[model samples]
Target chain A: MQETRLDTARIRAARQVIDPIFLDTPLYRCEALEPVLGCAVSIKLETANPVRSFKARGTELVASLLAGRAAVCASAGNLGQALAWSGRGRGLDVTVVASRFAPAAKLDRIRALDARLELVDGDFDMARERAAAIARSDGIRLVEDSLDIETCEGAATIGLELVDAAPPFDAVLIALGGGALATGVGHVVKTWAPGVEVICVQPLGAPAMTHSWHQRRVVTTDSTDTIADGVAGRRPIPAVLDDLLVVADDAVLVREESIVAGMRMLLDHAGLVVEPSAALGIAAILEDRDRFADRHVATIVCGGNVDMDAYHRWVGARS
Target chain B: MQETRLDTARIRAARQVIDPIFLDTPLYRCEALEPVLGCAVSIKLETANPVRSFKARGTELVASLLAGRAAVCASAGNLGQALAWSGRGRGLDVTVVASRFAPAAKLDRIRALDARLELVDGDFDMARERAAAIARSDGIRLVEDSLDIETCEGAATIGLELVDAAPPFDAVLIALGGGALATGVGHVVKTWAPGVEVICVQPLGAPAMTHSWHQRRVVTTDSTDTIADGVAGRRPIPAVLDDLLVVADDAVLVREESIVAGMRMLLDHAGLVVEPSAALGIAAILEDRDRFADRHVATIVCGGNVDMDAYHRWVGARS
Candidate 1:
């Protein structure tokens, strides 16, 4: 297999295809948070997207490529909603195989998009297997986040937008799942702004990417539990792992509680409605503020698809 | 007093001053809602702003003009938080006099901006009286929403941005309170897009603006109460009334339940968090879907500052 790198050329191509559908989300300097962290902390608010997540960029790209074909994917929440929206917009039939663990609000959104919903009995991995089988049988396009080159290319546009919007940031923090966003964004940042650091944040319970980066091999876990359902996947695609190893500067594993706190912080101070997965980068920063001191740091708010019940519970507990 | 119409010249001036401080919120077609509404429905999503409201634009404009002077304002929620944020950013001392009826989350946000908060005993009118008194006694600039031409001009920038972003719209729906946003936006829309109909939506419990429009005078009520606290003021400012008489096409009062449902609709379908005042426009559309059939209409989502407790209750009621 050829190693894929999200270079400037790929980012340019991605922008040409994805710009119409994807929002160039704002990268605003957090004056209040900057003083607390001792750094010029900024937030790349991906939650401002039409689908309320960065997943829309990748899904839009992949959907556009599959112009006339049906699409199939599996997700706990955000990715499925993004695919459904993009697929619907492009006049493609989308079938989302979702785990029972998926948030109800997300399921409602997928249904509202008029996409077929298949509820799997087991975990996200099991749902992924069902989607893969269906896609293979029906000749539907499978838009895998990690393995798909188009997806990586689409995610890389974030880096392009960031560079165009603000000056060279000292560090960029991204939430890690199957490593597509981290690898894609990291590659672009390193290419365009070589001095910048790329830090990946993962849930402690689901640190497959972190472990893979440390061991220099692809890794998978049998089970992982975290509030960041969007980025709780255990397996890493080999292609994404290869790119991440080359470009990522460091990785941080954030606690579930901290992710919740990060969401609260954004809602309180920044007036942003972000899900736990989207808050991972902020959680990592809050965990180790000293690392970002005196630097111009940026963090991606990956998505906002929190379950209302769960959100209420989290808010109540915090109070 | 002279009627303050935000003509093209004033709008251009406002845009020059406000472009740097405020986000030019996207005016995108809502494809999903279009099919349901049988029209080309566009949404001007002000919830995408850094402060999560269009009020930020007006507040930033007013704060910049103040130039480090002490300022005071009264709000049910969104306006106070916006002023506090803009004032803090511009190094101005801000005192927000909020009513007991305001959302706790909004008060929290105002405090987070380092504004001095005075929680008044009564409703918005009482709070405004207190704010006016404080402003007079302390020699602070009073940033009243309606009477301030700068604030109205700042809010008019939304119309300019919308016209620049999309094709001519047939109609626009705005949530009305102190009427700065509705009046300002109406002025520009009527001037630039002459055929466009400007409709103002107010909560039935607090129909001061609607009554004023119908009676052809500024009207005041003994009391006003509604979930849309941001627009629940009793008395209408003379300037706002004059602007409304000249520019507005009609006014509609939405039920409190419908406002809650509209907020939920936005959260579920659009994945955007909007407060009750922001939901009023959507509520109007939902109430009379036939009026917009096959027409190109735009609605302004004015703010996002609901308390978690109140939000939970609304969600609970729906379930």
Candidate 2:
């Protein structure tokens, strides 16, 4: 398991260059959540950053190494915001290829940050393919978010912070999308404290990574359907899946209902306005508190970019 | 003006004892608010703490000095939550006297933190009188939030962080309540960057501190009415007023409508779910962006305890 793209040295060095604003985020226990989880749950709030997501770390890292070249990526969501926010400051040109279904609020923010948006009439995966093709045709760098080792290394700073804040946690629950965040944090925790458990959380509707781990190969789902849009993946990146295999100890699948509830619980108990994808960790813990009982658990509340109306509808519907 | 309470040395020392969770809050540029405010605005989010307010720093510091002795406070608000949160871990008894009109959501949190709540059938001012009377009759330590110099020094850690962050800022707007946070942060900014302007913000309906500063004495309002309940002070503590004179360069009064709009603006722009009182700094900047044009201004988003209904009323009113 020699990580060429994100070795110990590379991950450590990445810390020097990733947006300083993305580093040293607040990591503390939500006391009200502690009772429900039956453990001391220390959560690192990645929602406080410019993009209100951990994508800023990875995107900033990519921008720092772009050598002034134009870059393009496909994201209907958080990744686009990250690219837009980080790339604009570096004076690098960025174009995000998004599906027609991308939220208008997200599109507005991406445009606000000076990133060009190219909307493709297809599903997210199709839009991603078009983005890669466009990058190849135009001689621009394409950001393969989950497969980029540099991106993973950049996100490892979160693990670095978590380890430094409180070592020897019993378990860490990370949301599983393309497996970038999960593997990045899992790598650090496994390297630093080998005995600790690293768990990945995914929506039951989009369990590509979960099935990949179970079947011992990268598996793509037929159709992805989940309210946690950030973690809803229909396809798995092979390299990221392999990385997850090397670093993660377990995976958990959660219901969309629980995710909706978890988002509300987080808002009510912790005063954290995180999106459903970010609430997956808490959703996982809430799904089975007995497993994490009396253990010190660490999770990342990774994003808060949900639109005001959409959030109200989701949370209000549940309430 | 010789400062006895919040000198640099004491402020530094207070950081050591206050809950680690309350220190090193996220201070970064809110790029979205920059266009509206007409400057580079660096906002320190004080809402990330357990109690969702900057009061944790002050209360934790005061609790550190109490050495397990019983402490009582008059607050149906942030201070009570802070005392209950910081005191519970230290095995210190905390009693909160709340006015009948105090928000139930806040009272519920204070009670959840293991603090005893005594309801007084009157206004907030009457509740404060009862708390003072109870402390005297019961021989319990009274935690007079604004009057306690240790609390001021404790809250000064914010100043410490702010100075370390973006020093030499042209202006800093702090919400003026009982004046502890304003004075604490103002003292630090003024000490480190003497040329920097320190402006305090108060609700137009509750301009006691602003009027007191103008009169060079404590000012009492006949009737205090504002939606920004956290900063709606009917009377100013003399010592806090004097502290303001030493540290603050100016005080600004904002209309309640502007405060509501500021709350919506902050939520829409910064993804920060802060309360009306916490929105005062941004409210001040929005009041007269021309005055702060081209300045490197920093403001604290000091609390986030707004209930779901209240948050919707404020944020929904705009969107």
Candidate 3:
């Protein structure tokens, strides 16, 4: 198979250029998870960063390269905050178009990072269209998640940090949304340590990435209803779709119920209160324990955006 | 004042001797928290370790020095698990004396780490008494938390890693129990960066450490009636009490209500499901936000051994 992973050397450079806050995060063994999953699980937590997500890495590199150019983008929350925060260092101002109904905490973070917010009445897709239109009219560059090479290369820094984990991991599980995070991490993992398998996990509610990978083309779902807002995407990013075809060894879809269960387990056992999307990796492992039994597995905990009300409601429903 | 902090040289040496799992934890700026508290708050998360606590650092160093000798210790939970996990490397079998009423999840973790469990019929102090008796009869060493210099030296390694933060913090907040974690961390901060203030946090329900600091000697309380089991010691360790006089600048006692509030905030904002004792630092901050306002402050997030039901009840109470 012709593999077109992110440039290995560029990833190394990106690690140096990106914001240090996202660098060298905690990659520790979740002791309770080992017995439950019947495997040694090392979690690379992205929540420790200033942005509380891995989005900062890619955005930091992208903004640094923008070189004072103003950029317009659409995001539910994480990417917008990353861009706004990283852009400050490079004098690249950001105009983020986001859903009016987005979480207050995320919206507050973006604003605090000094991003100018354009609140749209409709959902995430509508926000994207508004960003594109604003970019055209205002003459600012429009950056989309999972579609840019600089973004993916910057995120590949996860590969650099994972080297520190004792009893090196054999396989990696990552939640696939627009595919930037998975492809970036997979690219580095495949390049730095060949034969290490990369598995993409997608929510059953937001199965665009998984569907597209299987069909060998882009896939669009009617709507994404997953509580994991970070990985809930309706349409597949074409560039990321192509990237995953080369880098992703396999993909799995997990139920929303399993996502809730995974989130609860992580809270109770691992002491992490991550977004439902972050739970997708754990959800996948829990859903199919036989496939991963006794394997040295690692997963990227991509975000920690859930609030108390939402967290309580999700976990409380099961009880 | 000729301060005898844990030999700064020994802390450097302990880094090489201790278990690797306890090193290089995530220390990052909690951006959301800064805005709320009106200060720059950097948190050193110790809960990321294999045992989900900083106790591993101390025990690892202690066990390594023991050279396969059997040891008996009494713990509420975190210390026992840390000893059990770290001792496995040095072939030091551990006998943990725990309260019969200890949390099932914590007890299970200690047992899983292959420690011999002795559940005493009374409270934590009674368990300590039982452990002392066991050590006397078995001719094994009885290692206490704060009395041991090697253990404190091991935990001081956190100070080594905190140098990575961009702006130097002016103050540090830590939860004090038997005081191994606080004294060790304080010892490093005091020796290396003398001006940085060390503030110890004790549960209002368990104010032995704070009371002892005021009295300039050991203090014993009738009962420790707080939800933060990790820092609920009825009696202060004498060596640590003296260590606090030189290394610590101040001590604050926080109410249980604030701990629940602090835990909720970390869950909602920082994405950490920590022990109520770990919440004590934030609780102290919450209890007196004005005192920390505009200061570059740091806190040690010491443990995350909370069970699902306890977590649900604590955070769920607010909703």
Highest-scoring model, TM-score: 3
Instruction: For candidate 1, report its TM-score.
Output: 0.86
In angstroms, give how far residue B59 of model 3 lies from its true place.
Answer: 1.4
Residue-wise lDDT of candidate 1 within B53-106, one digit each (tens)? 788888878888886789999888777888888888788899999997688878
Once model 3 is optimally superposed onto the true structure by TM-score, how far is the C-alpha of residue B187 displaced, in angstroms?
1.4
Ranking by TM-score: 3, 2, 1
CAPRI-style docking class of model 1 based on DockQ: incorrect
- Candidate 1 pairs with clashing backbones: none
Please tell me which predicted candidate would have the highest DockQ against the true structure.
3
Q: Candidate 3 chain B — worst ten consecutive residues by lDDT sum?
A: B310-319
- Model 2 chain B is weakest, by summed lDDT over 10 consecutive residues, at B310-319
lDDT agreement with native, every candidate:
0.80, 0.83, 0.84
Model 1 residue A109 CA deviation (Å) reads: 3.7
* DockQ, Cα level, model 2: 0.45
Tens-place lDDT digits, model 1, residues A9-45: 7678777777453656667776645555667777887
Give a tens-digit lDDT track for model 2, residues B1-319: 3563567888888878887888888888777788777988888899987788899888888777776789888884889999988888887899998876666677888988889999899766677898999999999998887789877877788888877764456777898988889889888878887787889999998898899998899889887888777776677888888888889899989998889878878877777778889889888888898898888888889888877677777667422
Assess every candidate by TM-score.
0.86, 0.94, 0.95
**TM-score per model (chain B):** 0.94, 0.96, 0.96
Residue A33 of model 1, lDDT score: 59
Docking class of 3: medium
